[model samples]
Target: MDDVDETPDSVLAARARTGDAAAFGALVVRHQPAAIRLATIVGGSLDDAADIVQEAFVKAYRALPQQRDLVSATPLDPEAVALATTDAQLLIAALARLGERDRQVIGFRYFAGLTEAETATALDAAAGTVKSRTARALARLRQELDRSGVRGD
Candidate 1:
């Protein structure tokens, strides 16, 4: 019989979930640069950007099973992926303009794929507070990106 085929992301994710540091390291090698580019666009410096990206990926990995569950429960479609990618980019750009607290909120909510409740838990803030902060931070980032002529996709 032929070996079962698996997509690279699925394989990597599985390996990562199983605590294979090397597999996770490979995943980082594959995706970290894109994450860093996004973080730099949001965090304003190479060092800060790298840090943010690293944090985001760590958070992403921690939340991956939940994210997959949510996705599976909903729908797996191109539109969803496209929307998520756009939102991620927008949030990254916005995070770059924010202070530490605001950045943490956005990173946890958007990149980490956390719900408001989950975000509140992680941040030790009220859900309402997380929601408001996310909204305000996003609005400010939108304004800043617009002023900078970085059109949102």
Candidate 2:
């Protein structure tokens, strides 16, 4: 990890796609904090969630691209991901603004501790779609929080 702090995720992901192990590792390092927070929310008991989410996710192949793109697409900070991690009220307020399906997807995956397969079953969609939808839902939530001026420390 050379100073990847300033590097855009797109470049890191492209390099990762080409099997540049260093670049792949760099990408992982850059996204680790945000991704870990995601896993906790979308996957177990707040205390038990980290292990469950960590076990369920390893590569994040499907998610990495969108997450990478989201970095450029939104003004939300990695720190905002931490906002929901810190404040229950802010998370709920943001969640309330999402459409029904988005809210359900997040609720099922995170609040209810439903597996992607289980959530897909609940949503009547395929497993892959669940993953994609969850990613989009989270991005939207973060965007909403940012737009609404929710600050987390």
Residue range 1-153, candidate 2, lDDT tens digits? 567877777777666655567776776666656555654444324554455445444445544454543324444577886765667656766776787678778977876568999999977999999999999998998898898787545
Maximum-lDDT candidate = 1
Q: Candidate 1 on 99-125: residue-level lDDT in tens?
A: 877666776777657899998997888
Candidate 1 versus the native: TM-score? 0.49
lDDT of 1: 0.69
Q: What lDDT does each candidate get?
A: 0.69, 0.68
Candidate 2: misplaced stretches above 4 Å?
1-86, 151-153
Q: After superposition, how far is residue 13 of candidate 2 from its true place, in Å?
A: 46
